[model samples]
Target: MHHRGFDDSCGLECVENGHDSNKFSLLCSGSAVTYASFSSQNESKAKLASSAAPDSGATKGGSATKIAWEDTFEVAMQRARTEKKPIMIDFYTDWCGVCKQMDADVFPKKDVITESDKWVSIKINAEKRPDVAGAYGVTGYPTIVFAEGTGKPLSVIPGYSPSTEFVGLMREARAKWKPEAAA
Candidate 1:
């Protein structure tokens, strides 16, 4: 559902159909909306903002994958448990400047993408996943955490890094969490 020109503190409510997978896309005109929802039936809701949604030609690699925190916890856990590959959780906020810098200067680069493909990549909004952020002790924006499991914390790379440096960090990520070593 798209909402434009909403108030700064406006709230939203959503209801999902149990039979069908509920896919929700919400767009706000500016950064002035507050969305709230309650479900009567037991159903999961995945929200993608207009700004965060993939744009045309933004990502060069076709295989660059993105998973929100809420939907992929189980898959993340299973990957960590079965494959023994650590998870890289990117704690980013939509409006954060450094996060955008990392997205542009580091994450989408060929080297970073190639290196990141070795492990599970999760893009988590700190606003959305406060618990995960707190669990990892994330104190700032664009904090990257490498963990052997979803709930476990291993190593952290804070602040913005260029592509090459970020690749080195990924290598360190591999070294720190041997489970996430390149495949």
Candidate 2:
């Protein structure tokens, strides 16, 4: 199968030739947006590779955020339990434009990254993890579910949320597990 992508900046796009267990990606202008096959198993490494790119965004003190997203639900749940934080699971699909947009625009922003620290962040390919997605009752692309450390969902952001709005949502969802908020 052949996939096509349209970026407002770069109209030239491809979703990768055919499909493979491994993903295919292209770096537009060396640092713009990444056009690739997004999968849970490899996106972590992709994050590492992209961290050094020009548009990768930086945290406070200029440290590059590297590999912060958990690749799977099970790992994210474990981290949520260990850190005593809520879980933010991003259920996305390869063909979802909003999902790719969020990956390129929202998830890498400094504010979103900072707010994400309050929860255990994860990226789940809904097509790859239909069981998990179905269990969460996710019927849309880019269904971001904020759940307790125990994995009970508290709230959801069902579609594309820009960085500014996304940060607020993250703050609200994360607050659910806070001691003061819980009390």
The global Cα lDDT (0 to 1) of model 1 is 0.55
Off by over 4 Å in 1: 1-71, 180-183
| Top candidate, metric TM-score | 2
lDDT of 1 by residue, 77-162 (tens): 77656656677777878765446556654666777766766666677788888987887778666788877754566678765555
Q: Candidate 1: which pairs clash?
A: none
lDDT of each: 0.55, 0.64
Give the lDDT of residue 86 in candidate 2: 84
Counted clashes in each candidate structure:
0, 0
Could you give candidate 2's per-residue lDDT for residues 31-104 as a string of tens digits?
A: 32233334642453344344322222223222346326776688778777776778888887765554666777
